[model samples]
Target: MKAVRLEEIEQLFLREVERPVPGPDDLLVRVEASGICGTDRHLLHGEFPSTPPVTLGHEFSGIVEAVGSAVLGFRPGMRVTGDPNIVCGHCVHCHAGRINLCQNLRAIGIHRDGALADYVIVPQKQAHELPLSLKPDYGAFCEPLACCLHGIDVAGIKAGSSVVVLGGGVIGLLTVQLARLAGATRVVLVTRQASKRRLAEEIGATASFDPTAGDAAAGIAGPDGLLPGGADVVIECAGVAETMEEMPRLARPGGTLVVLGVMAKGEKIQIEPFDILFRELRILGSFINPFVHRRAADLIISGAIKVEPLITRRVSLEEVPEVIRNPARPGEVKVLFMPSA
Candidate 1:
């Protein structure tokens, strides 16, 4: 099997590796497509906490090559995606239906050998069946889409509301689509990338803004300009301290600000005291997918969300290292690796 290994901080290589065997409760998947995420970059840089020497890939979809003895409801040749956040059922969070915050969680790619190879093992409970209507590349997107769904769940978005999503990356673009589905009347996407901004608009954002333009604050303002609180809900998806700090400033009074991106450890953000006190804003942070993978699959199968346009590029497993080195090489949006390609 060929796998992309994270040999050390800021380094990755595609090399020959032994294939893994599935436990009785696990399913062995022949990975077809795997999405490259910011987390992969985080793993390469050793930024986010994780185990070292791990085969890195979590956003993936594949055909079941084999199943453990105990596995049921699925057989070999079944197409599946899965919840990568494996948690101990005994944990308080797990028992409380908050598995995403489980005390003893071990992610496949982040803590073990994931699907960045010809084959990878996933718990049967984590594996989700895919519909024939979906292409494999789109199936790989279920994980990220699940994470975004979890964010919108926590956000409690209301109908006729306005939304502003920071950053025009995959997460931001997904957020825009989810916001529209949540019944938000108008959604604005803000990013530094021109290509991504264009993608954002195509994905249902009412408007897209380049923060680099003069006074982005003004451009983001709502109609009539009476309040800088133009956005009813501000989703911070940039993963930058500056964007995180600006969340409160971009929301309407009594608005909700959800931080959906992962910032580096020990980073700090400055917020004005008045924004929290006078505005009485509701600020929240969104974490991982939280057992929402199946819901995401349903969303995809039912055609409730469209993710085909989010895939900007596809390459073979051998190109994984190079793709990570330069994510901005040309196109923007999610990049999927076809391991068997």
Candidate 2:
């Protein structure tokens, strides 16, 4: 089996390795499609903490080639998406139902061998079933959708609410659709990319704007701006410092702001604590999918969230290392690695 291995920080390659056998509580899945995430680049550049000498794909799904004897409700030939994050059930966070904050978090792609190869191991607890009738590539999006679902859950969007999604990448685009589904009457997407801006509106954004053209904050929040007094909820999905600084500004006084994007470790951003204090704003940090994987899968299977538009390209395992190393191409939303391609 050939796997895309992160031998160490700044070192990645496609190497031939022995196939893995499943544990008693695990399933051996043949890699079908895996989405290349920003975190993959972070792991490559050592921006995100990860155990090296492991496969580097977390947003992945595939057909079950074999199942462990202890596994139930699943069998070979089934399609499943893996929730890569594995939390210790005994941890304080887990006991409190905050498993995403588990102290002993060991993600499959980050901490163990993952689905960037011919075969990867998934514990029964992390496996979510998908319909076999669904598109093969669509399954790869379940993991990302799960993460976005958590952000939406934390944002607490309501009917007739307004939302501003910063950045037009996969996360932002998905967030836009979810916001609308969550009953936000007005959804505005801010991004410099003209293509992505157009796509955002095409999907669900009531409007889209180019942040580079003028003062993004004022343009959106000014009296004559789109939202006028500002949106009811502002989500920072860009993970950049500028957007981080602008998140609070885009939300109306006493409104909510959710930071769902992944910023590199040690990255710093300047923020005004006075504004938050004066306005009584609510700020939240949403982590990975905690208990939303199943809902994400159901959404994907039911076509409640559109993912076909988000997939930008598909490459084989041999091409994954290069794709992960370079920055995303302009207008590129998501790229999937098909080990069998």
Best by lDDT: 2
Q: Which stretches of candidate 1 lie over 4 Å from their true place?
A: 222-228
- Estimate, for each residue in 77-168, the C-alpha lDDT of model 2 and write its tens digit: 99999999999999888999999999999999999999888889999999998888998899999999999999999999999999999999
Clash pairs (backbone) in predicted model 1? none
**Which stretches of model 2 miss by more than 4 angstroms?**
none
| Worst 10 contiguous positions by lDDT, candidate 2 | 332-341
lDDT of each: 0.85, 0.92
Q: List the residue pairs that clash in candidate 2.
A: none
Model 1, 1-341: lDDT tens digits are: 89998877887999898888889998999998999898898788778988878889999999999989999998998999978888888988888988888899999889988888889898998889996567888888899899899989888888998888998888998899999999988898888888888888887998888778755566676453323447888999879988888788778788889999999877888888786989899989899998688988888888778788887878898888888776455447788899545
Best by TM-score: 2
